[model samples]
Target: MTRIPELLAPAGDAAALDAAIRSGADAVYLGASLFSARSQAANFAAPQLGQAIDKAHLHGLSVYLALNTLIAQDEMETALQIAGRAAERGVDAIILQDAGLAAELHRYLPDLPLHASTQMTVTDRAGLNMAARLGFSRVILARELTIKEIEGVTAEAKRHHLETEVFVHGALCMSVSGQCLLSSLNGGRSGNRGACAQPCRLPWTLDAAQKDPFPWLSPCDQSLLDGIPDLTRIGVRSLKIEGRMRSADYVGQVVAVYREALDRLQDNNPLNRQERDRARERLLLAFNRGGRFSDRPISGQMGRAFLAGSYSGSYGLFLGTVLKSDPVTGVLTIRSDKASNRTVTRGDVLSVRMSGEDKERASAPVGKISQTSDGWRVQGFHPDVLRTITPGLQVYQMGSQ
Candidate 1:
C-alpha cells in the first residue's frame, strides 16, 4: 500500500482557511497576530485563532500555528505564552524556526507536536539528526534541495523517527532558506523575523547607465504537481503549498488543482496529458511569474531563464499586448499572442504591463469581454486606469472570479 502524504495549504486568514478546507486540504498552516513570518498577512488574534481552529477541526482539517519567526531573548516569554494558548486551543501542531524556542516549547508542552520550519535550513542527515535531538516531530526540508536530495533526506529522516515535509509549490527565494539577510540589510525588516519587505522583487541593474532594471534576485514560482508520485514513493509525509499572502481565490484554485492531482495519484490514476495541461492552465490562471512555472531546485538551474529577471511579481496568464485604448470609455483592444486557448470573461482580473517595466501599470476587473476580429475588446476599467492604457502594453489575467 502506498502511503499518501498530507496535503498542506496556507491559511493566512479566515477566508483562506475556508478555501483550504473547501479545496480538500488535509491540513492548513497559519500564524497568530504576533511572531509570525508573514506579518503583512491578516493573521488571527487569540479569540479568532480559537474560532479558526474549531472551524477547521469541524472539517477534519488539522491547523498548525506558525510561530516560525526568530524569537529574541526578550520576546521568548511572550512567544511561549502564545504557544501555550495555541496548544490549549487544540492546534494540531506548532511550526517553529528558532531552536531555542523549540526547546523551550518542548519543555513547556511536552506532548505538543513541533514542526521545524523551512527557515531552519535543514537539508541533510546531520540537520535532521539535530532537529530530532531538538524534539521536532517533523522537519520542512529547505527549498533549495533537489528531488534526489529530498529522497535522501527523507530516507535519513525515517531512521530518526521524524516525518519530512517538502514545499511542492510556491515562490522560491534566491538565497538559501533561513539564511537571507538581504532584506534586513536593505531595510530594517528581517526575513528571519518574518517582516520581509521583499526587496528582492525590486529591480536592479549591473550597468549604471542601463535603462531597464532586472529582478535578478527573484526566481520563478515552483510547481511540483508533476513530481507528486516521486515524493509519495520516497515516503514524504506532507506536501506543502506556500502562499499565505495570496488571495482566497488563488489559495482555493491552487489547492483544488493539487488536491485533484493527489487524489488521482492515491488512486493509481495519474493525470493524462490533456488533464495535466488543463491543471497547469488553472494554476497559471490563479497566479504565475513570467507567465510560467518552474521546479527550480529540482532542475538545478540558476541562469537568466531561471531568474526570470524581465518579469517579476505575480503576473498571471499572458493574454497579449494592447493594440488600442479608449481612455474616455475605458475600452481596450488587445492583440493576444500564444494565449489563444484562454478566454477572458466578465469579473476576471487583468493586469497591464508596459514594455521594459517590472511593475504592473494597472490591474482591473473585466466588466465586459468580447472577441473581436482584430483582437480582444475588454472594458469595465476605472477612469483612472484608462490613462495608463496604451498601445503595445502587455496584459495578463491575474485571476478569474
Candidate 2:
C-alpha cells in the first residue's frame, strides 16, 4: 500500500486538540502557555499539555508541542523547562525555531524527536541537510517554496535521511520565513517566534496620493489542496495547516476536506469535479481571503492582496454548527450558532461537522427537491445523491418545517 502523508492539524487549545484528532488528523501541533510564540492562542498549561498528550495517544494520533518561537536570554530557562516537560509527557516531538534551542533540547532530551519549524527558513537542500545534522529529525520547508524547489529539497532531505514536512494549506506569509519584521515594525509584535501580528493582512500604501484611495497590500491564503498529489509524489511526510486561532468547526471542516481530497487522489483517481468544487466551497466558508471565489489558484493577484488585508492581533473564524438538514424534500438547513452571521447559502458548500467532543460525528447533505409530492416525499434526484445519505433513516434539516 502507498504511504499517505501525515495530516498535521493545529490545536490551539484542549478543545482544538480533540477537534484535530476527531477530524482524522494523523497528528496535531500545539504550544505551551509560555515559550511558544502564539501568545494569543489558548495555549495549554503544563498539566493540560500532559492531559492532551494522553488524550491524543488514546486516539492513536501523535502530539507535537510547539517550542518554535525565539528564546531570549531570560527565556532560555523557561524554554528548556517546557521542552523537558514535553519529553516527560511523552510528546512525539518538539518543533523549534531556534537552532540553539533545538541543540539545547537535543542534548537534554536525545530520545525526543526534534522538528525544525518553518521559522528556520529552510530554503535549500544545504540548509535542510544542516538542520538534519543538527539533530532535526524533520524540517518543515518554508511556505514560499515552489513545486520545483520542493522536489529538490525533498530529494536532498532523503539523501541526508531526514524527514521533510510542508505547509499544504494555510495563511501565506508576506515576507520570507524568519526574515519578516513587518509585524514588529508595525505593531511591536515579532513574527519570528509566532507572535506575528500579521501586518501583511493589513492594507498598505506606497504613494501619498494613492495611500487613502488604493490600499497597497493584499495576500492570498495558500491552499495546496490541489497540489497534495504532487507533494505526495515528492515524498513529503507531513502536510501542515495554518490557523492556530481558528475554531474547531473550521478545523474539522478543513481537515475533512483535505482528508477526503488526499484519499481520492491516493487511489489514483482524479478529484471528480464535484469533489474539487466541494473542497473549494468549504474552505471559503471556513474563512478565506478574496480570490476567484475561493476555488481559484492558492496565490496570485487578487488572492494575494486579500490575504494581506491587515493584522488585527486576533483574526480567524468562529465556532458554528449545522442546526439542521433534511434531504427528503431537497432543502439544507444551517445556523451559525455564533454571534456573527458571516454568510450561509444553498449550493455554497457543506462539510461533515467533526467535533472534539464527538469523534464519530458525521453529516449528510440536505438537497432541495425539484418536485414535491403530496406529502414530504420529493422526486427528481440525481443518482450520485446516494452518496450523501447516511445509513440512518433520520435526515438532518433546517427551516420552518
Candidate 3:
C-alpha cells in the first residue's frame, strides 16, 4: 500500500514538540533558538536542540528545523551556526526562506535535505522550479492557494522531482504568505522572520488606513478540514497543521481529527463527509480564529500570554475539579474530594465520562455559585458531567467521548 501523506505539526517549544509527537504528528517543525522567524517562541536553544531531535527520531518521527528567516548581512554568521548545529544534531531536514542559504547549506551539508519554507512563497510551478534548482527536496507551498492551484503545483512539483506540502489547517495571515510587511512597517516587528504581532487578529477600522474602509476586507482563517481528501487525492506529500502558538489540547484534538480523516481516505475513497463535518465542529470548539470562517482570538482577549512568551502545558478545560458552588459569587470552589486538570471556569464546556446508555460525555456552563465550609457548589449548563461526579475521585473534563 502507498504510504499516507505525512501529518506535520508545529512545536513552539520542547513540550509542544512532545505533545505533537504523542498526539500523532508524523513530523514536527520547530525553530533554532536564535534565528527562527518566530522570535517570540521559546524556541529550542542549541543545547536543547539535540534532545528534541533525539526525542522525535526516537518516536520514528522526523524533525525539521526552521532556519526559515531572511538573514541580514549581520545575521548570516549566526544563522549558519544554527544550521550547522541542527545538521550535526541529526535533524531530518532544514527549512529555509532564502535561496542563498539553501544553496550554502546544500554545499556545506550535502547530506541534509532542504525544505523551502512557505516564507519562500512557493505557490506556483515557477517558484517550485526555482526551489528545485536551489536543491530543496521539498517545498512547503503557500497557504493561500486554492485546491485547483494546489493540484497544478503538485503536478508540476512531481514533474520537477520535488515533493509538495500544503497547510491543511491553521491560522492564516491577512496578506499572502511571505508577502506581509504589516508587522515590520507598523510595529517594527519583522513578520517575515517570525516576530509577527498578529495585527490581522485585531479589529481595525479600514477608514483609519485611508484605503478600503470596510470590515469586509478582513480575511477569515483558512480551514481545509473539509478539503483534506481532495488534497490527498492530488498526491500532496504532506499536510501541515499550523500552531506553534497553540496548546496541547488543540494539537491533540486537531491531529486526532485529521489522523482519522487520513485513515478513512487511504482506501482511495473520499473522506467520509460526516467525519469532515464532525471535524469542523471539533476544530471550532477547540479554539480558533472565529468568524464566518473560524475566528482566531485576538490579543488582550485571552490573556495574550502567548504573545509575550510560550507556555507549553494545557490551560482552560485542561484541568478542573468538582466543587461546591458559591451561590452568591458564581465561583466554583474546589471540593477537597475532587481535583481538576487545570481550573473550572464559568463558560467551560466539558463532557462527562459515562458507562452504557450515555453518550459518555456531557457539557455544562457554570451558572450559580455558593461556597460552603466543606467545599464549593456551582450551577451548570446541563449538570450531566458535574452531576455524575463521584465523591472521592476528582472529575475533570474528558477529552472526547
TM-score (all chains, Cα) for each model: 0.92, 0.75, 0.74
lDDT of 3 by residue, 226-268 (tens): 6676677789999998887777667777788788777767665
- The candidate 2 region of ten consecutive residues with least summed lDDT is 392-401
The residue ranges of model 3 lying beyond 4 angstroms of the native Cα positions read: 208-218, 267-271, 291-401
**Candidate 1 residue lDDT tens string, 268-356:** 88898889989998998888887788887876765666665566567687788898888877788888776456777889888898776
Error of 3 at 396 (Å): 19
RMSD of each: 2.4, 10.8, 10.4
Candidate that would win on lDDT: 1
* Model 2: how far residue 227 lies from native, Å: 0.4
Give candidate 1's error at residue 289 in angstroms: 1.8
Residue 305, model 3: Cα distance from true site in angstroms: 28
lDDT for 199 (candidate 1): 79
Collision count of model 3: 31
lDDT of each candidate versus the true structure:
0.88, 0.68, 0.68
Off by over 4 Å in 1: 207-212, 321-331, 335-339, 354-363, 372-375, 382-393
